[model samples]
Target: MASIKTFINDDFLLENKYAQELYHTYAKDQPIIDYHNHLPPNEISDDRVFGNMTKVWINGDHYKWRAMRTLGIKEKFITGDGSDKEKFMHWAKTVPYTMRNPLYHWTHLELARYFDIYDLLNENSAEKIYAETADKLGSQAYSCQNLLRKANVEVVCTTEDPTDSLEHHQAIAKKDLDFKVSTAFRPDKAIFISHDGYNDYIDALAKASGQEINTYGELCEALENRIAYFDKNGCKLCDHGLDKMYFESYTESEILAIFAKKRSGKELTGEETSKFQSAILLFLSETYHNYGWVQQFHLGALRNNNARMHRLLGPDTGWDSIGDFPQAEKLSAFLNTLDSKDKLVKTIIYNLNPADNEVMASMIGNFNDGSIKGKVQFGSGWWFLDQKDGMTKQMNALSNMGLISCFIGMLTDSRSFLSFPRHEYFRRVLCNLFGAEIQNGQLPNDMEWVGKIIQDISYHNAKEYFNF
Candidate 1:
């Protein structure tokens, strides 16, 4: 028998009796409502199938690419130039080195759940597992639609740019599939002035909205037009990817001056850039309030850190890192600025740094009144923190500081369909946390209440929060 087959029959979860009881009592059949993700809306609409397993899992996933790079695999094996087989082998070589990293767990879990293969991936088993999984990719069970069905996803929201055609989203909506699929408006390209193509993006926005981009007022009008278009097509959420919340107050005059400088084909200073960004954020927040949409801020990510690699492979190709900054003060000021004016929308704050987990979790409590218990939420463990230890820390902190009953659950933050297994990983961790509390006498063994709590965190909270 193969080592993987031996591990499969051995019942890994059964070794921990507490995990078994919790899995049976709390986590078996909960529906999944993924409120946030990076899945392409068009693929879901088309019910697309991958050309191969490597294409589906390795092509666009920077997470795996980063791990392969860390293991001294050449860039060719990652984002550079390499055949699918070569890249898969490079990943296989790195698997044994992953050891205690969450990547090891996620990779094995995906293999077992999807392929029904139980072998540990290493240099020895890599070729066999890859060939076997690749062969299975030709079957109907490995189709993209089947993957979502297997994961039991009830709803999925994909992040989309303002300039997107959304033809795929339209196709999916028209099909009326069992699961609800929608788009989240992500406008980082339009707002981030430091990007190389800021001027080009202005042209794109102008074309999309049929408005001439001459001044600041015109720019705002173009954005508003795009937002309306997005809303008409089933967008109820706006997502902002920023290093931190911008709270610097600026006057209309200041913004007009900055736009004039840019319109003249000149760059603004750092101070001017901050002011312009803050003003745009405020304008967007006001729009979110007007549309009654949920606003999500993915903060604390220091993107494009490695300039050499960034220039070599472009952005999001594993050049980003966790930022070290005091988010609470600025984030609080920004939220309060909106809250005081009664213009705050349904808000979720996700942090990258674990040290700020408690701070961000507790900060939500300061803004929550009796009006809505869970209106302001600390989102699921994000980016670098999307792992077993990170999820556990977030859950424990949120439960300790605020009402975990109202907490929304896991999101993949992934571009791959194979990432759906993440929901299962999160469920197991959640059950273990609650079960341990019960076993230790921290709480009474009321399976009903515990089950309800598990169900709410797993699915209900996200469904209600996103109003899906």
Candidate 2:
């Protein structure tokens, strides 16, 4: 908000001279380590190109889709069968409404960074802007691999299910691309034993692991085999998405009986479901520890709120919101269990609800034990809380309650290729925080040390954290 002449010039988010210097010098040119994202490895392997802007930019982009729907746009122009240009036009028309939202800045930043078009997109500029981007995207040079290279990304870990073949990841590894593309084991389908088609998913898991799951121990063995396979294929991280951390008490015998009943087509009661989930999650976390892999827990998301729309569209289509769950107690117990067994691997806890910022920042300290630098990380602002206010709150909390210096920084946690600018957005916000403190004399005037810290957070820490 401090007077800036250009919309997205060199000093876009950097307000003061100190902020400007920190961003331009320390953070700007650092290669990105997108430790977590949803980019399709197949596209990276095949170097897929798009025919138009809508295909790569808007399609499957729930962020833009939600904004378009909010502007009273019809479904036909959104996820419906409307033409690509029609969808792009609807999004262009919706851009101005997103003025104060992060989308406004992101839209212009992407346009500037990717296409070098500085014109504000709206009804008048939509046609020209769309055409210009369409031509660039249609070219072979703008394929998925080239797009990632353009972003200066060093490594990106895409999330995958247990039943995944990892074929695309295998092919990408064979290419020996300049940037490293890796996968994270996401075994949500195996953990959520109470959800619909749980047994069917287990059947698929059995097929993938080449094992028949008739008992609880066998299921764990199947998951263990897949973990070994993923580990062999260069996977370095694992991720989980849960409404809250589960830590219910139950014996192995009870859990076995519960799974047996479920496999026999009987539904588990609430207690049984909790116990089963807690058991499998503990098993997975311990296994991750054995493999020397970093683990991530994305908690507090309340997904699929609209049933009618869910029936039409399905999950992860912008229907998720923050869940106000009782976090600390169960999360602490779960981690403590692993830590007590000396089985807690490097962990990153991402809270969707900003209210838990301080809770998570302080919670990581309980089990850090000095075994690793920032061993238990309070992760970056995620999902619903990825904006400026949210990111600032998270960083400030981490700085206050924990050491922000050792932190592994921002990740897109996104599905789009252009979303890499979000890392830029986070770096600017981080520099602004450190730079502002320097301006006010809260921190030393030493630019060298401050710049070092900024560079570490920007790239070095993640590089070392994952050892990539």
Q: After superposition, which runs of candidate 1 have C-alpha atoms over 4 Å from their true positions? A: 5-19
For model 2, give the RMSD to the true fold: 1.9
Residue-level lDDT tens digits of model 1 in 211-285: 898899998999999899989999999899999887787889999999888877797888888888888898899
Error of 1 at 54 (Å): 1.1
Query: lDDT for model 1, on a 0 to 1 scale?
Result: 0.84
Residue 205's C-alpha lDDT in candidate 1? 88
Per-model lDDT: 0.84, 0.92
Q: Write down the worst ten-residue block by lDDT for model 1.
A: 7-16
lDDT of candidate 2 over 1-468, digit per residue (tens): 122127889888898989988999999999999999998888888899987888888888888888988999999998999999999999999998998889998998888888888888898889998888988999988999888989999898999998899999999888868989999999999999999999999999999999899899999999999999999999989999999999999998999999999999998899999999999999999999999999999999999999999989998887888899999999999999999999999999999898899999999999889978889999999986898989999999999999999989999998899899999999999999988999999999899999999999999999998999
Candidate 1 structure, TM-score to reference: 0.96
User: Could you tell me every candidate's TM-score relative to the true structure?
Assistant: 0.96, 0.98
